[model samples]
Target: MAARREQDFHWAAVDRGELVVQQCRQCAKLRHPPLPRCAACGSLDWHEHPLSGLGRIISWVILTHPGGKDAVRRTGILVELDEGIRVVSNLVDQENAAIGARVRVEFGEPGPQRLALFRTLAETPA
Candidate 1:
């Protein structure tokens, strides 16, 4: 785990095919984009914990001209995890993204690092 920041741990976890978040050991609160200290209680004692990889789409944007072909091929979403952490990542395994959609975290190769992205879970036919 040669990560410079807290989010680096999350990225590292994703690289290992796991979803993790920063949890304050003192306050037992989860934090995203990992901070040096817990925002809830200013606790520097923290640990990385695995998440369920389930979340709902809170916001999203479609990039028509994302500066490159690969960028344009993907869609982005801001997902609110069940633990209350919101992460902005690309949505995979789908053709389009929609609001209020249920999503799960997935690992993908995006540049030199392993990245986490959201993939739409298959919907049960109504």
Candidate 2:
């Protein structure tokens, strides 16, 4: 499969330091990995809904690229947003990572492209 032009808005928003998901115009259901049509209502009409950039780590995994010139390891996390949307993003600050840790979106240049990575939220002084 190849990248679709419909997804350009997503990367463009990321470039602008904004996180967004596609909201179906018909059913108002939000979905990540922007699709051309809504799976729920089969509606082609949709709009970009800005995310809170807040979520909790529901799951995670450490991925190691073995047997490659650029072999490296990184932690990937599955976060369920406060709005109930689940997104897969990489964790930057892996120090206090836990399954239910609170995290927020942080943009970073992994290579030449800006991407939405995440990090554990700082604990408040009590």
Candidate 3:
């Protein structure tokens, strides 16, 4: 049997320790929340392209309420990747993530499954 390809490319990127996004081979357009076909050109030909793993914390929300059974206990962020793909994911390795802070992708077990979690990147002294 073929390997269980992830329905979401974000998960697939996590598996590879890299942040990636889908791009249409025909129109050369970038796409987020991966789909089976290109939304711009309606082409089936596409490929996964690695991102810079750099992004800004556009917006975030801390969930105080539980999501019921099987929900991973964590905070969420609506990060905008360097390539301009905005995706919602859990932020990790920080006491608190704030808006406009630099974040990078880190793979870890958010629940029973491994996933891509964003963390604050160290700032270099100027």
Candidate 4:
């Protein structure tokens, strides 16, 4: 497969335990899955803006497919970050998750690389 080239700047931040998004220098719009040019202004120049790593679960699903013995079940969630960008990551340290549940980021160094994972915040009794 061909290299993406855009996530280069993004992974650098992830390795450092920080999540960043590309913001167009010309239009000031933040973009995830970083791209080379701005969608709004088509500006090549941009900056890496750090995110708060706080978000809510917009949606989620559990994966139980076959991936050999090494396959551990996981929940993939669409997190709507506080900065307004929606990110796809795994929801960990919990049993079942719900839509609209708040989450906080947790850095995981699974191997040589680091990734941003999330955990559900404790829900208050209503």
Best by lDDT: 2
Model 2 Cα displacement at 31 (Å)?
Answer: 1.0
Task: Please list the C-alpha lDDT of all candidates, in the order they appear.
Answer: 0.79, 0.87, 0.78, 0.85
> Candidate 4, residue 124: CA error in Å?
4.8
Alpha-carbon TM-score of each model against the true structure: 0.82, 0.88, 0.80, 0.86
- The lDDT ranking, best first, is 2, 4, 1, 3
lDDT at residue 48 of model 2 (Cα atoms): 92
Highest-TM-score candidate? 2
lDDT of 2 by residue, 35-86 (tens): 8889998999999999999989998888666655344457899999899999
Candidate 1 vs candidate 2: the lDDT winner is: 2
Better of 2 and 4 by TM-score: 2
> Candidate 3 lDDT (Cα, whole model)?
0.78
Q: What lDDT would candidate 1 get against the real structure?
A: 0.79
TM-score of model number 1: 0.82
Worst 10 residues of 4 by lDDT: 63-72
Candidate 1 lDDT by residue in tens digits, 28-121 = 9988877899888998999988888888888787656646555436677898887888888988855657777888887878667778888887
